[model samples]
Target: MLWLDLEGAVNVRDVGGIPTDDGEKIARGRLLRSDNLQNLSPTDINFLVENVRLSTVVDLRSPAEVTSEGPAPLTRIDRVLHVNHSLLPEHGFAATAEALLVRRKREEERYPGDPSCAHYLGYVEHRPDSIVAALRAVNRSAGAALVHCAAGKDRTGVVVAFALTVAGARREDIIRDYAATGERLDRILDRLRRSPTYAGSIDSVPEDHHRPRAETMEAFLEQVDKRHGGVLSVLGGNGFTDDEFDALHRKLRR
Candidate 1:
């Protein structure tokens, strides 16, 4: 993962150049992952739109977040397709993204195992419809597809990991890509702390608890393999086929 040095989002990166198990590397400027894009500056916008040629913004935040955060700069761009598809549960406004993260941690701490892995799996198990929709959004893109959630760790991580696995990237590479977010943990936490929607929830949790470990992602992948027969099976069970995944691979590859 090649990190994008943007002024607004701290966790933005191009998930290209990753080697597939087939000995080919994923293409650049095609598949990018990011954090909250609500704070992108004019220069940042210009760079993404002009330089990166970002064509779709796949927001995984809930409708409440889209409203509470107000209109982002990317939402107004007529040329870019903004797929504000939220994988978040439809329970109500009370379940903010950060709150769920902390809750997952608490649940994990209560037991000796990682409940957060279940939370990640929930995206595939409980929210397969939403997952299919998001993948379709990526598949339909005419240019670069940028996927993002709040911190671009859990939700974004799982989605990207699944896509890479489907696209033939190696298992260790996928885990490393997820753990790469930790390299920007300080900046990511700072970006979250400055936001009203997340500040309160994140402040209550220890920063050490926020770190994205390789084991956590590996655990999630293992669960997918053991229970669901791997990533493609998860996608296939969700109605996404080899053809659909190939379309996404083409959009992501050179």
Candidate 2:
């Protein structure tokens, strides 16, 4: 995981150099993941546009959040293709307490062992269309595709994990990349805490809830395997054809 030194965003990293099971590695500059682009500075924009050659951005934020936060800095960049693929419902963030309670109930019903694992599974179960859209946007990118959500740990993690899995990345490598976010959780949380869109919700959550545990990702992969027979099956079942899968694999793998 190569962390990008962006002035505004924390928990940003290039999801490259990850070894696949067949000996190939994910190409650098092809896929990147970050927290949010709402606060990206001009210099940060130039770096991503010029140096990283980022041409696509897959935003996983909900419609309500987007409306509240307004357009991100990347929206002004004509060359960048912005795709909104919200994995949750439009009114998902209506009431914080109600939402949390509903989520906890669903998580408990889905996976009795880990709440995070259940939450991640819900990403695929609830919104296969959005997941398909995100992967398609990534596959169609002319250059690097930067995928982000508010925290870049859950929605982003699930999408990136599916991408890596479909591209033949090693399971451990994917888990390591997902778990890497924990190292910068404080900075990521701090950035979110400063944003009005996320401040209230984040403040009500426990500190430990922010940490990305390796086991959570491990169990997520297991759930994917057990429930959908693996990433390929999940994608195919979600309307991703063979050609689309091939295109995504070729774009990410070296």
Candidate 3:
């Protein structure tokens, strides 16, 4: 039943009412997460610009994804900060396989080459930079903001998890927000799988091989705890000062 009003972008949701530290609740409509808005409908774009009142957008996909897919053509908002995460390489034909191979290598080093955990844990360790940047932008924005990557799950999910945890959201609530992607990710994944950019990248792999599974999500969170020492550590290490942390909880939580 959780839904947002963005017209073209799926997986957009507010993080309000989630508990933060000291019994506070994150304010709704101030922070949003979603998949890339490159194909957002006009009505949706209008609504986002006029109604949601967004001040900025933080893009977390790789530089490649931005070049190929571009972004939603519409933004009444003035600023769009594109700090693509390295792990989720830009979506492209040749680059897809290369990115996966790089991930495979990193995973091997981290977990003796378990592909599952490699794909999951690698992002958890490195996403703090992106998360911190997004939060800082949100903190400075006068109105609403949106953060996203290709599917709005992996990179975007970690940022969401960190924000929710720091703001006092229960673990279950955090996971629930992440789990919402299950219902909305299919179309984006399907489009990517069928594209020649994606297909040509994997010679013999089936289309289904490229899509993330539910187990991938579970593995990702497990890796976050295992490697990053939990979300708080990651946040703190990313330069979240104690005073700023308290302010975030206050601003987000009601």
lDDT scores for all predictions? Answer: 0.83, 0.89, 0.65
Superposed Cα deviation of residue 65, candidate 3 (Å): 1.8
At residue 143, candidate 3 shows an lDDT of 68
The top-ranked prediction according to TM-score is: 2
- 18-57: candidate 2 lDDT, tens digit per residue: 9999998999999999998888999999999999999999
TM-score of each: 0.92, 0.96, 0.78
Better of 2 and 3 by TM-score: 2
Residue lDDT tens for model 3, 1-254: 23685656667788776665466667877788887677678788667767877667777766665667644575433454434444442332234666667656766787663455565565655555656777776666666767787677767777777777777787666777776777765665764555444444544445454444555555666677777787777778879788778866655665
Please report, as a residue range, the 10-residue window in candidate 3 with the lowest summed lDDT: 85-94
Better of 1 and 3 by TM-score: 1
Clashing pairs in 1: none
Q: Candidate 1 local accuracy as lDDT?
A: 0.83
Tell me how far the alpha carbon of residue 218 in candidate 2 is from the true structure, in angstroms, after superposition.
0.6
Report how far off residue 61 is in candidate 1 (Å). Answer: 0.8
- lDDT for model 3: 0.65
On lDDT, the leading prediction is 2
In model 1, the runs with Cα more than 4 Å from the true position are 93-112
Give model 1 RMSD, 1 decimal: 2.3
Clashes per prediction?
0, 0, 13
